[model samples]
Target: MASSSKCAFLVFLCVIVLLAPSEVHAKSMAKAQGGWYLVEGLCSKFPDCNKHCKEQGFLGGQCLKLGVNMLCFCIHT
Candidate 1:
């Protein structure tokens, strides 16, 4: 009887271990994603601006001009 109980307990533990990864993955998928961080700097075209931002380890970037120089809002993930 004791051996049977131990076997049952081991099976339960194995099942839990098998199910745990899926639960963690599901939770992570369900959780809200992070927001974008804006990095302000001088820029020219949108492509060049975005490329520079990505090169700087950001997610992407966009150029918006306030005056003479187009301000590059580098998107940092």
Candidate 2:
């Protein structure tokens, strides 16, 4: 029983270590791609970000046409 518990713990630690890099990379990518910052029930788009959406350009102008609530929350500067 003790051996099995140890093995399980070791496996869990190994999984965490292996997955950590990908998780960090994903977070960095999201930051790099820009993200919605929540502030007082308002979501603000990162306009001065290093990355921009090539399809719609910026969230302030055309992406506003998607849905009223979502556009309001996500498109605010």
* Candidate with best lDDT: 1
What lDDT does candidate 2 reach at residue 25?
Answer: 16
Stretches off by above 4 angstroms in model 1 are 1-34, 45-47
Per-residue lDDT, model 2, residue 10, is 100
Per-residue lDDT of 29-64 in model 2, one digit per residue for the tens? 112125552111211342423233322343432222
Clashing pairs in 2: none
Worst 10 residues of 2 by lDDT: 24-33
Alpha-carbon shift of residue 48 in model 2 (angstroms): 17
Instruction: Report the C-alpha lDDT of model 1 over 1-77, residue by residue, as the tens digit.
Output: 99999999999999998766433311111111365646344453345877887887877767766444456676644
lDDT on C-alpha atoms for all candidate structures: 0.59, 0.36
lDDT of 1: 0.59
Clashing pairs in 1: none
Which structure among the candidates has the greatest TM-score?
1
How large is the C-alpha RMSD of every model relative to the true structure? Answer: 15.9, 11.7
Clashes of each: 0, 0
